[model samples]
Target: MKKVIAIYPGSFDPPTNGHLDLIERGSKIFDELIVAILRNPDKNPLFSLGERRAMLEALTADFKNVRVDVFDGLTVDYAARVKAGAVLRGIRALSDYEYELQMAMMNRKLQPDLETVFMMPAEQYSYLSSRLVREVAKLGGSIQDLVPEMVERRLREKLDPAIKLQDARKMKPGKRA
Candidate 1:
């Protein structure tokens, strides 16, 4: 029997509890789970690619089959390079299906044999997202539920003390972008 390798590609920015849940669940079905960190030059995340990878590695340290890696360019290319049998996606809501479906379709076109599998996260964490986590953390709100303690600390270090205050000053009323 051929071993099944699944690729879960994302910016991760800062992996959260919801992400961990999906990863842990996916690892059970595939012989190897690749947690790929894709480069997004457009995103000025608080965490660097290396920092994000380290955090994820620490979070998933217990899963022997799970490995952390980084890649640039198209996901299909990465999937093909790794010989992934399936691409793992976590669906949080009905709205996400449209985009995910479109991506899956495109990936199928790129590689007909490659498959995409969607996993619905647990109800309690379905609504949790990286944007929400950052917004809460930016405003001095608690992120205990959305992220791991390490992620929370990283967020504080990167955004708190002085940087967050500087950003707040630039946020004038009616300035929404």
Candidate 2:
């Protein structure tokens, strides 16, 4: 039997629990799930593509059917190139559905064979988003349940370098950023 493959594309600056929820559920629905990272250079991302890929890899290491990859240009084209049966998306709210629905229709127009599957994250994660996670971390707020432990650590390292240095100095007598 031919494998049923689906592509899940996203920026994933820091993979949050909500994203993981979708990935976990999507993985079960498809024979092979490709977690493709969008190389969008237009927007400044906190984590590099490589970093995001690594985080995803680590988080999904246990899922043998799920793989992490990167791509540029149209997502539908990428899906076609990979021979994906569907483009999987996670919709958290109506606002997201409005934008994603338009994109899904556009993609369907481009590749009639490729279908778009929309999945919702768990209820606890309904209101979670990477943007909000970044904002909370930037403001030095707790993000314990928002993202994975590794991502939380990385976020603190990236957004609070000065704070870390100040903390270290207080602990010792010299450390600086």
- 1-177, model 2: which lDDT tens digit per residue? 888899999999889999999999999989999999999979899999989999999999999999999999999889989999999999999989889999999998988989999999999999999999988777656778889999988888898865465455556745332
Worst 10 residues of 2 by lDDT: 168-177
Off by over 4 Å in 2: 161-177
The local lDDT score (0 to 100) that residue 14 gets in candidate 2 is: 82
Point out where model 1 deviates above 4 Å.
Answer: 162-177
Index of the highest-TM-score prediction: 2
Could you tell me which 10 consecutive residues in candidate 1 have the lowest summed lDDT? 161-170
**Cα-based lDDT for every prediction:** 0.90, 0.90
The TM-score of predicted model 1 comes to 0.89
lDDT of 1: 0.90
